[model samples]
Target: MNGKEALTPREFLRIADFFATNGYRLGPKIGEGTYSKVRIAERSNNGEFLAVKIIDKRIAKKSYVTKFLPRELEIAVLVKHPNVICTYEILHQGELVYIIMDYAERGDLLQLIQTCGGVSEKEAKRMFKEMAEAVKYLHNLGIAHRDLKCENILIMRDKRIALSDFGFSRLYLDQQHGDVTSKTYCGSRAYASPELLRGAPYDPRTNDVWSLGVILFIMICGKMPFDDRNLKLMLKKQMSEGVTVPETVKTQVSSECVRLVYQILDPNTDSRPGVVDILQSDWLN
Candidate 1:
């Protein structure tokens, strides 16, 4: 059934039969959105693990129902990369939209950061290298993950980074393949770009770079680069005062890595380095 449309009684019955034949036993909820919840699930027959994202269309906002949700489904199904989570199936039953994805047993990057305080320079380079590659691939395909915070970066059991969540993601190209600007005001304020904070029509590609910089900063510094409790103050700090590394971890992170963070977190979007630039930087190698 098309996720965009409402399902009929006959269609619902058919899908129910399908579920009965090859279904997943739902487990505890691991993640959530405004109208969606991500829960761990296991295949009934083989016990294969999966993350099931269930979206309740009945209670979704009008903008999300018509705009972001559709784009998320389209892009999520379209992308396939080792450094990104894999979508196994999408089922639209009645008012529910179920998206089955690969399960990351080690949880998200945010969890790791909480447990380890801050990652070593060498370890951050390795993990962030994979994340940059994933973002580079998406950008090459004209997609911009408007939300690029640490929580969206997942960790597999082997410690590989799997970039997840595309609810705010969309192609940043026009019909003629030209650049396009967005005014969606999506993404967490802690990781939001300067232009986004100003509520201007901003280029999502550059906006994504800013969020990536914040993620990298937190990975190495074990703290947010700028305090976002006050949006106005946060924007001011983002543009002028520069990053405030914690006193405890000041000497631990390399100057080279710090330089890249500043370059990526540039207030002038045009001056900010893209993901490819980060991948080619000296710190990563």
Candidate 2:
């Protein structure tokens, strides 16, 4: 453990006291962030275990508390899908905001991928399908999971994928009633599309597709599609006919599966397939 905590021991005690009043008993620390920490909480009434993300508004940047925090709260309530993490309750007291959600005993997809060096093609197919379905559901609701990554994809007790961490999520449609152009630089650079890397205004939906492709590639190949160390070269490879997978690794996975990843990773946003196309892919079927 780093031993550095967002919440001091006293702060945790204060929050625990607050939750007790709301029929919850805070337990062990399960997760954390720069400005917040997640603890497992038990409901006093029914003994249901849930995760409470305690965000300290005092420590967090003003812009986050005023902007992203509100949108995240709104999106958490609106997003209701089997494959997505369920936010059961949201409570606030003074400078602390509490987001209580389903407690997934298992860790995230990234941890699973790293531990096993990657799963078999069949396993990848099952996991990716769930991830795609979650993204599809969010898009249908005019919500964009702008930060889709292995880390954000949680592993439930059943080992099913539950897309989580919607701090970067946004309701993307504009007044003209269409996907709006994005200039805000959000999400990890490793999972970003060519347009996002270029710092240009682009469609967030297709950008999301590119990120999904990256995750799928990592799941099957056990590594990233491009090395971000050389940004220029990575962008060059992404835009060309170069095969993303290593020659040695290519022989292990099926050509069809590789093709599907390549298609979704297309740098040309116009040609990039959406979450729906990915869900309907033959490999997934």
Highest TM-score scorer: 2
List, residue by residue over 192-214, the lDDT tens digit for candidate 1.
99999999999888888888899
Determine the backbone clash count of candidate 1.
Answer: 0
lDDT (C-alpha) at residue 258 in model 1: 79
TM-score, per-candidate, Cα-based: 0.90, 0.94
lDDT of each: 0.85, 0.85
lDDT of 2: 0.85
Candidate 1: where are CA atoms >4 Å away?
1-18
Count of backbone clashes, every candidate in sequence: 0, 0
Clash pairs of candidate 1?
Answer: none
